[model samples]
Target chain A: MNCLLCNCQLSMRLCITELFLPIDHQRETVCDACRARFSAYHLSKQCCPGCGHPLNGELLCSECQAWKNNYGQFLHHRPLFHYNEAMAEYMSLYKFQGLYQLRMVFQHVVQMAIKQEEYDLLVPIPVSPTTLRTRGFNQVEGFLEGMQFHQLLTTIDDHKARQSARTRQERLVSQQPFQLNNNVRVTGQHILLVDDVYTTGRTLYHAADLLWQAGCQRVKTLSLAR
Target chain B: MQKTDFYGRRVLLNAEEAQQIRIPNLEIMPAVKKNGDRIYCYRCGQTSSCDTSHLPNNQYYCPVCFNLGRSSSLACYGHLAEPNHFTLPTSILTWSGQLSPLQKRVSQAIDQGMTNHQRQLLWAVTGAGKTEMIFAGIAHALARRERIAIASPRVDVCLELFPRLQAAFANTPIALLHGRTPEPYQYRQLTICTTHQLLRFYHAFDNLIVDEVDSFPYAANQALLFATNNAVKKTGGILFMTATPGRTLEQQIHRHQLHVHYLPLRYHGHLLPQIKINLAPRWRKNMERGLLPLTLIRSIKATLSAQHQCLLFIPHIDDLPLVEQVLYRQLTNSRFTTVYAADPQRIEKVQAMRDGDYDFLITTSILERGVTFPEIDVYVLGADDSVFSSSALVQIAGRAGRAVTRPTGRVIFWVSALSRSVNDARRQISLMNRKGRCLQRELSSL
Candidate 1:
């Protein structure tokens, strides 16, 4: 097998348990060198509880403070990795270039992270109909393969620019682009929202705000990158 | 959106650009075609078993050539027939440089091959003015209104060849294409591009000259070979120029399947420098202990004392830091730097070496080909390592004694255990030198 990212030949040695066990597990899709490029977030570090951004001994970041003032409640988001250069390159290939095979690089990590969170419904952020048509598969859904997730939200048909193209101020002031799907039960239920990346906290906030209006008891969010 | 952009090229267009292509003569086809259980990419010409590169809704994208652009079943490619729209110029050859008599002979053979549309190979030694020898052939093809392209496997070779080609074909419009080039593609009679960029072309060139055909990533890559075959017209000619032809090309020559031209001597009619092998065991262990072999250090000191630069070719990049430290400790007064493929300042470092700024350089095989440093000696510290192919070793040895003023220099290989590649490299150099000696005698008598 070869790494999905670097295309180097992989020689995976079989462990004792793997050699004896009859059950087949998913093989590694990336080499150790390529995998080492992505760094996981340090949860022990002082960070904002609202958005998980690194903080210098502060209660909340300015963006999360604004979120708390507007909605009377802020989302508690757990991000897996930092949005460093390697992560940015990974996003460009996996999302922009649409290399479907690259989803395997981080699928297991995202799955394992999602498993740690407790929620009644795992709701993945939805792509617009146009994006669904063009990009084929929803990027957030690509990371959630073989797992149970609810597509409770659907994006509104707004032909606006992509979030990545917008500046920070523009992304912060952008209006909500998501709505709850028809006839979804969310009253008094704990909801967990999933997204591929949490850039300025606007996208996840929009989805969380809709779920809050739908009378969910509590809402939490998780993303692959901050 | 110009019609000329799609002429003789298979271009992937987005939704916005696809709508603007209003040309009626253009042929449109799916970027990828799906068979029973496999999907074939039209651009790279590779078929995969639909297990890994699949998408939703029975769609698939090619993973092989995804770096150029994603070619999927959902995308379509536009190909306009090659118009060959070139205006015949009054004077196509602007190069005033003189070629040696032997070089002139090889140049005529290349011109004949291009005229007859036959596949040929030019087996020239290093520093034989191979680029100058091809000017007449390219000029002839341009005069006949036939499109020509010069491609190489390495981007460095393409970049170096582009300016020389521009100076040679002064009036002809030449386009330089590569992965990182910011300029958009244009319809030019002549083009200089890397081999990877040839995937975007379809029967585009009447004559394609591939320099350094035995170099890496193109020497044995099936997809690139397929691209070369697909990029040329059915009746077009191909001329592969290389100092060290690989086993496949050698077999082709042996079978009389390929027309061959040999320029065994250098432009100055001098023979190649022979390689001397010295066994140096535990060199890597000693390097880790901050020490170099006595023989290797003596050779470096000798070259430096003689006021000549030397290149120390290591087997791997991982050993560069250790070797650099050892060299600094041993030769404290001399100035040097180490370079590898990923070094951001590799080009600048090579330029500095050419300017006589450094006494010696520790480098990997990245500088083994397509570079020249005058009045320099060459040494391979780990010549028996698996990384040093026979061709690579020969290229490294060729780096020395290239200038006319310094027709001879030292070439040494410090090997722990002599291997077949090392032996083969030494034997090949001797054989070339023998042939070059015979050529020299004949020319002197004449």
Candidate 2:
């Protein structure tokens, strides 16, 4: 494998002796040349702590600024891919087609985005039963394999309040907040929520609110594509 | 976004897994599976996929974000693709062509009445050639350029009848839609599908004919019936085919509210099958562990010595292997094979038997209906077991006498108790044959 930028051979480079050394594959791949370049890339420019849009910080993206009056504040969110044809087909096959091999493809893309990024936990957005039934496997969970699991960052809303709301956003806003199972401790913990594609950030914001309310110090999201 | 952690033993997705897509207005969810790799939701029917709602009343619902949804019904991906055979009837005539006078008359009434009415039920008796009766209706609708759909609850039976239906009509396009097949038949003139698959059509089919309406999976779910109706074209027709009508339909039949036609006897004049019962000690238990309760074993051996063919029907799929093994040991000299729905080689094994390669065939209720054997006597080792409903038992009994020359055969229900299914089966057949005799006598007088 050759680096897209440098054309340097991108094989896992290590001496036979380094086999016993503790290492992170992501760190190895985020080479000095690549890491330094990625750090400066305009795509990684600072944005609102509440949203990952181009930030003048004068106002929040409509999703974040008015979210509290509606859903709530998101500490921050990030996406690796723009919602496009490649990611759509990739996620479709990953979720619907039951293409297990594509997990490696997803992992590679996710790994590159998360390079040197720190989070106490990486939560996967949950898939519903209806969706899971249609596709034998959950593609979000499919993409999350071999990665750390965390608390449910998002959830559906109130049992009765949304007795009238039909839109998915209404469903999300009205949904009861999703939390981790009984055993996990997320207080003061920073999290990296992972998903296949980045959609309207309502699901992510609600997930952040739940974690924040549960005392998580920070909540960040990372997806295969924006 | 929130960080969520689940203490539940997380999920694993493997190759060969059935995946249901989250998309609506698309038949894209992975097929629900009885056995294969599947990731189930916390709610629903405790299978792959689930209703997204949780309840405080201790009822089953989604455990995660509460989204109200239905139970986890298994997904059927649709039918497998087979080459379409639409050749018009030529030298190849149908089984209906050989129907007796009474059979023809009753079938004609059913054909005319059912298609004439927009919504009606038809209660045909156990030995009635229901499929044969429907050919005229199917032909009538086709002649008017109307689309027709004939579906059954059992996939195995629809598969058995598909080729037969294709053979009956010439140059008529017929598509057999089921879970295993992928393509939707938007263009085909005729469709035969399993009832579970009707949910996918959503008003795509016209002239919906549901065979075995009072059967499982569909029987328990009212939504299935709704879905069946939903599959039909507006102002279209529904013709339900059943050996035994339910209480409501029976009442309708008595009131002449339902358009019912009866074929009391086999197409050819054959006596109703003889039912010989033996109350042996846990016959199935003895048969397992290679012991066939001496008495039953001896009877089987005696039949084998006479060079007669036999079909052994066990009650459950779980008992199939043991039943097969025991029968194999006892009838070592006979050509025999076992087939079941679970066995991928099922079609192959049945085909082998059809080819006259096997003298003895062991099977389960999967072959209880629609399949025909030349002259094989059937032994329902656990016939009186609760699994064999009255209708199922009657259908199984009908299998013995479908072919004219093979009309006379032995049917043994080696059971511990006289189950209602067994008794009802006996009564229904006896009553039908008695009706047949009365009709014959009336005809002679006329």
Candidate 3:
């Protein structure tokens, strides 16, 4: 098999794990060099209870504290990776360049992260109609390939620009863009809002606000990047 | 958005606009296509079985061409018969530089091709002033109020050509587009862009000149060839400029599908530096043991003693550190640097070599064609290695004897054995020299 990114042939050999395990679980999309470029967030690192930004040893970061102060509700958002320059480039190629094959690079890790959580349902942030037409795949939903997710929210605003295209101030001041579908019912369930990145947190907050209004008992969030 | 924004532009539409926009003569733009479960972009077609684009119910956007803006199945192309703007310059050829008599003749031929909208190949050798030869033809097309674009496969080539073309046609508004450029693209009389950027244009240019058509990934890519054909109007002209024309192009010329114009001689009227082969068996093993071939070391010492820069082209990038280690011990007093394609300091290192900061640059074939350095000798270690193609070998030889001041430089192919590619490259260089001699004789007679 060839590496998905570089097209170099992947040298696969039967290992000790193959003898013990009947089924093969190795699904490496990127070469070791490419995989090394991305610095994955260690699960052992101490993170802010609200947004999951790594804090060396502190219980809560200033940003999450400020978030708690602004909105009475605090979201327990667990992010898988830190938003570094390498991650920025990765996102630029995967999200902006629309290289859909890149989604698989983070597939197994994201699936494992999702499996660790015990949310009643997964609610991926919906892309606007314009984004749906232009980008084809919703980038937020792209990482959750084999995972079960509920597309219970749809974009209600057509004029709103993408969160990625807006500035931090613009994203913060942006109005609500999503509306819950008629069939979505989480009256007493723990709803998990998933997104690709947590930039200003306003996009997820907007989704959470509508879900709370729709009578969800509690709301937590998960993202690939912070 | 206003209707004017979409005019003569490739834009995606929502489900409502896809059904409602009924512009006459509109077509499902060839840029976007719907394959079974995935949408194949007529642009950058990246085929992977797992297409995740969740377009609104069966619609698809080609993720491959997303860098040039999105091309999706739900989009429709609305093209104007002619560009909305055209301003003919009073003096199109603003540069005061002179072309050689042979170049003038070739320039006239290209101008005539532009007049007749013919597909012609300007098979010029490296350092033949290929860019300058196109000025007269571009001026002709500009005076005719036709849209023109000079596309190359390499962004470095496009970047290098943009300023030169800009200076040549001082009055013309030129737009340059590439993958990493932050400048927003706008319609211009003369557009200079990488071949990949041509996907965004639809029948946009009347005179399309493809420079370095033999360079990769454009030489081997059918999609880019299609983009080139689809970019120009049906009646538009195409002039291909290249130092090394590939087999397909040769076949096309023989079949009379492509008209050929030869400018085999460099503007300096010098022959290409012929390649000299020296065998060094078990060179890799020798290098691993810190043993250097005395002949190769002698060549490097001679080139350095002559106060000329040299490029040592290794077959693989992995061989760089080992080669550097061996060379550093032998030539400790000399200033030499190693670079490869992904070297972080590749640009700076090449610049340093050009700026006369380094005596020699040990590199891979990444610096094969786009770069130019004066009075430089070239040595290719492992020339018999399959990593070096025939065209690449020719280009490597073309690197020598490029500058007008020192138009004769040494090019040695140090190899274990003479490969077919090496022979073909040697033959091609000598063949061009013979053609140059004939052309020179013909010019003198005329």
Candidate 4:
């Protein structure tokens, strides 16, 4: 099999290892050289307690500290990689370019990270209707391709600008854009909010607030990039 | 009173809004197909089915052309109005350069073809001043208040032609469109763009001229052919100019689908440089053993010592590093560089060679055409390889002896075994030279 990202011939042994082992996060769609280019976040690195951005051994980064000060309810977040140049290019191709084949490049690693977590339900942050109409596929749902996830939270406003388009301060102070689905029950359940990138923690916080209002006991967050 | 830019200029939307402004200009052509909820676009012609969306009713979006601002079923092509104003200069052809008698003859035929609105093929040999011959025809079209577009298969050709066209038509506003170029799309009397950019235009030009029509990704490609056909208006004309016409174009000529015109002589009145073959058996094995073939090494030394630049062409990009290392050891006293298609320093290395900073440049076929270096000899390491087509071999030989001062240069092909492509290239060059000699004799008698 050839890697989908680079079209390089993939090793049969590596494919077999990926098929048999869960911890072996090697992907058939990604070549070894391209995989090495991604700056994956390590648990051993000094990171912020809230957003998971790499830090200098501080308990919390200043941005996370500001978030904690503004809102007492901080969602516990885990990120798989730092927002390096390679990750930025990956997002540009997968999200902006609508090259859905690149979703396979980060599938295995993100799935493995999600498997290590403990949560009753996984809910991906919903995209605006305009994004779905234009981009054809939800990028966060693309990362969680085969894995099971619930669409409990629906975007409330179709005309609201995307969180990525807003400044960090604007995003932090923006009104809620998520509304819990009345038919689905999130009450008294541990919910994990997933996204492709955690830019300012505002999008996840908005989703978490709606779940809290729906009587969810706990809320955590997971993203492919920070 | 609000104004919005449509093509390149701003116009008031009026009270009827943008919809009324877009309606009268657009008439849906056979370029759109509907199957159930999906629609296929004939413009970018790359996909069978576009993704359907649930906005403004069920709309279909061509995902392939999303980068070019979403060519979809919801969008209508801009209807270009006929030019009612003729802002012709006193002398439209501002070029101070000279064209040979043969070039002038073909140039007049092309101008006549544009006026008659017919398809004509200008089969000129390389170094025949093809671009210079088109200036008169373009000037004629501009004076008639006709929109003109010059499309090529390669971006390098478009980039090279843009500035030359701009300089020739100083009074006319020209737009250059290519994927990598930073120039924005605009409505001009003259437009020069790559063939891929032709998909964005609909019934846009009154006269379309396609250069390098047989080059890669354009020859025998249906999508590009569709774009070329659809880009012109119903009554518009097309002029195809190429050095090496591919098999499809030749078949078309045989079937009388296109009218043929020929200019067999170069601008300097010299014949194309013929290719000479030398057998280099197992040259790759010799390189691995740290020894170079005596015949190939001698060829490189002769050209370098003669104070002429040498362009050593390799068959594949994978062989570049090994060949560069072998040549570095063999030609110890020469300064040379290796370049390939994906090399980041490709442009800089080529400029360095043009500036006479390098004695020799070992390159792949990427520099076979659209590049000219004065008094340079050409060599192909493996002319028998499958990677080297007959047309490519002709173009490679055409690279040599391009300058007016040095009208002749050596073209050597070092092959392990004689291939049909190699023999065909030699025969094509000899055939063109014969035709050129016949033309010269006819001119002398007249």
Give the top-scoring candidate (TM-score): 1
**Candidate 1 Cα errors over 4 Å, as ranges:** A13-15, A22-26, A158-160, B14-20, B35-37, B285-294, B301-308, B324-337, B342-359
Q: Write down the lDDT that model 2 would get.
A: 0.60
- The residue-by-residue lDDT of candidate 1 on B1-446, one tens digit each, is 78898888899975546777788888887788888888899888898878888997888888888888889877788998788988877889999998877989889999999999888999899878899999999998898889899999989899989999899888987899999999889899999999999999998999999999989889888789899988999888889999988778878988987899888887777788899999989888878888888999999999999999999999999999899988888898999999999999999999999998988899999999878998899999989999888889999999988999998889999999999989888887887887878888898899
Q: Write the per-residue lDDT of candidate 3 for residues A1-226, one digit (tens) a residue.
A: 6676666877767779786888866656778876777676665457678876668877778877777787767788888888887789888877776666678878788878888887898989888877665566788787887778999889986845777788888888888888789886788888888899898789888889888887888998889887
Q: Top DockQ: which candidate number?
A: 1
Candidate 4 C-alpha lDDT tens digits along A84-157: 88888878766776665567678777888889888999999888876776565688887787789999977776
Candidate 2 segments exceeding 4 Å error: A1-226, B1-100, B115-129, B138-148, B154-194, B200-207, B214-221, B229-237, B244-257, B284-290, B324-335, B351-357, B443-446
Q: For residues B1-446, what per-residue lDDT tens digits would candidate 3 score against the true structure?
A: 34433434455554466578776555445556655665566655554232555353555566555556556565555444445477677888898898777888898999999889989999989877788888888888888888889999988888889889899899988988888889666668888989987866667778899998888888877678878887888889999988888777878999998889988888778788999999999888888899868998999999999999999999999899999999999998999999898899999999999999999999999889778998999999999999887889999988898888999999998888888989988988888999988877877788
lDDT of 2 by residue, A73-124 (tens): 5456666555555456555544544443345444665665665579778788
- Clash-forming residue pairs, model 4: none
Whole-structure CA lDDT of model 4: 0.78
TM-score of chain A of each: 0.96, 0.65, 0.90, 0.88
Could you tell me how far off, in angstroms, the CA of residue A38 lies in candidate 2 after the best superposition? 38
Candidate 2: residue B402 lDDT (0-100): 61
**Chain A of model 4 scored by TM-score:** 0.88
The CA lDDT of each predicted structure is 0.89, 0.60, 0.81, 0.78
DockQ of each: 0.66, 0.05, 0.38, 0.25
Q: Which tens-of-lDDT digit does each residue in B149-234 have in candidate 2?
A: 78888787789889989888746667787767676334466777787656545444447788887666565455566667666656
| TM-score between model 1 and native | 0.93
**In angstroms, how far off is B198's CA in candidate 4?**
0.9
* Best-to-worst TM-score order: 1, 3, 4, 2
